[model samples]
Target: MSDREKLEARLVWERPEPASRPAPEPLSREQIVRAAIALADADGLAAVSLRKVGASLDAGPMRLYGYLSSKEELLELMVDAVYGEMASEGPLTGDWRRALSAMAQRTRRAAKRHAWFIDLLGGRPHLGPHVLAHVEATFAALSGAPGFEHIDSVMLAVGTVDAYVLGALRNEASKLERGMNQAEWEAVSGPYIQRMISTGRFPMLAQVVRDATHPSADVVFERGLDCVLDGIAARLGR
Candidate 1:
């Protein structure tokens, strides 16, 4: 057989190219949303531009507009996507404290998974389905807790844990960006403390600094949750 005939016979239909596909007919909204989410995850929210997202999907920025109304809508969608990462169930046992603790730990783990999610504003509630699911789950966890009488107290409790977790994660991101190990950071900041000690301009500040430590946020987090639970238990009369 001729070379052309032999080549035609040997062609593999199932081995079609991924990158060479004709951009998948019409672009999907889910496609655009996934591309946008990944862009923010890889680079950061600041780096997520419509053009960049479209380029990733082998399309143009105008195509993305057909999926999302605006950049703000895209960001809101991405925020909900992160909330979808959370598990909706609490601890197996019916103990309120244990359930809440499990939730706080899981939520903190989610922050580590999606660092971009820390940018979500806690004061303003987003009504996205995934975010609403998260709220429903959290309230369910503390359902029988004594002091969680109303949504206000429940919100305050959840807000405290979320605020602590978000702030801690942001600080962690900052330390990572500074490109120094914890020991190196402490060593560099140590000299400023020494200078203050010797100058005595602020004796009280120096004393406090001398005793201060950069404890892992986990430690502070547990302490803060303990406080919240303590208050709740007090109200429960347990």
Candidate 2:
């Protein structure tokens, strides 16, 4: 397929109805996507495939082709499905800072639930319905902020929150993936780090490492988020 055709195919919503339809079966696109998500959650994104998902559903791999044409399409479907999980209960209440903070928290929770999600984020264009709803809600939150009267300003504010959340999640997810409990890591690396610091070549690094208190993951995330929000508030003079 040409690039345009591929892009069209990737968009599940834009696809035209099949000229002829097969008789309805017990399976559905939702089921297929859910099965794929389960596989990804249990293993990792790399473990998700047509064959594995089919096995999970007790159907042949060919059965999924009716719903998703390729692995890329499957991934897009999976991404949208997770975004669906992030749907907020109500609309933004015009408190831009609170709305942005809530949205960041929701995204972080979703990433924690679906660790594989962090890998797929920004991997491709997400024009899916759920993703668009998220974008719309964010814009609505920043719509009338003092310095964000322009759409560009609104988008910049939203992007700033996104960047901060994604960066924080990367560090959080890495710790989980390594299976290294904080105490265990400290025990293993503490002696080695102290020995290196004793060499006197890195006094500044040693001093900082010794003096700085290690905060819990939740504390670190909240502190970083507050700092970002403060910057945005300052920019908007709010």
Candidate 3:
């Protein structure tokens, strides 16, 4: 069968009901997905496997196949589970800017909590219910805005937000993966950077590095988000 067909068959929301039988096993797809997420949370994505997840649940590795056919499926479900958290925040209010900004911040927070999540950001297609719900929320936020009446415009706006958030969080995740805080990163790299600046080869960059006051990550994120929203507003002529 095609991969799409296999995925459709295995979707947690689309699984068929089993024939009448004895009581259900203590294990479930939800349980398996949660176990995998916890593994990823504690030890990063590479540490997550059906074997490890099963051990955590006191079940055998083979037991996971009945719920998720492969590790790929497990990753997909884990991503959707995160999307579920984003969706549970409820629908957007009429103010698209505020709604989009709030969504971006929430996504940033989720990425921070689950650093492994950054690796999976836009890694594959997510047709899971929660992922679709999040998409719907994005559309709903921009639905009636002027100059965004076209579906393409709505999608572009949403995509722009997604792109910005992913790019920002990618940088954050890299720092985390390196186990270095901002100050430490600077301290370690500062000498080389200062030497490069003093060479006069990158005068503009050197000026900015020397003269500009670097903001905290949170402040930088908010400011970047505001700039993106301002661009969107200009496009919408709002």
Candidate achieving the largest lDDT: 2
RMSD of each: 13.1, 2.6, 2.6
> In candidate 3, which residue ranges exceed 4 Å CA deviation?
1-7, 10-12, 17-25
In model 2, where is the ten-residue run with the lowest total lDDT? 16-25
lDDT of 1 at 94: 57
User: Which pairs clash in the backbone of model 3?
Assistant: none
- Per residue, candidate 2 scores C-alpha lDDT tens digits across 1-238 of 8999987776677774334434444777788899999999999998999999989888888867867788888888888888888885566564888989888888888998999998888655687788899889889888877788899989898999998998899888888877788788879989999899999999987988889887889899999999998999898775
Backbone clash tally (model 1):
0
Question: What lDDT is reached at residue 135 by model 3?
Answer: 84
Which window of 10 residues has the lowest lDDT sum in candidate 1? 11-20
* Model 1 C-alpha lDDT per residue in residues 52-130, reported as the tens digit of each score: 9889888888866656657777777777776676654433245667766776677677767666777765656676777
Full-model lDDT for every candidate? 0.70, 0.84, 0.83
Q: Evaluate model 1: give its lDDT.
A: 0.70
TM-score, cand. 2: 0.90
Q: Is candidate 1 or candidate 2 better by TM-score?
A: 2
In model 2, state the lDDT of residue 84. 87
Least accurate 10 contiguous residues by lDDT in model 3: 16-25
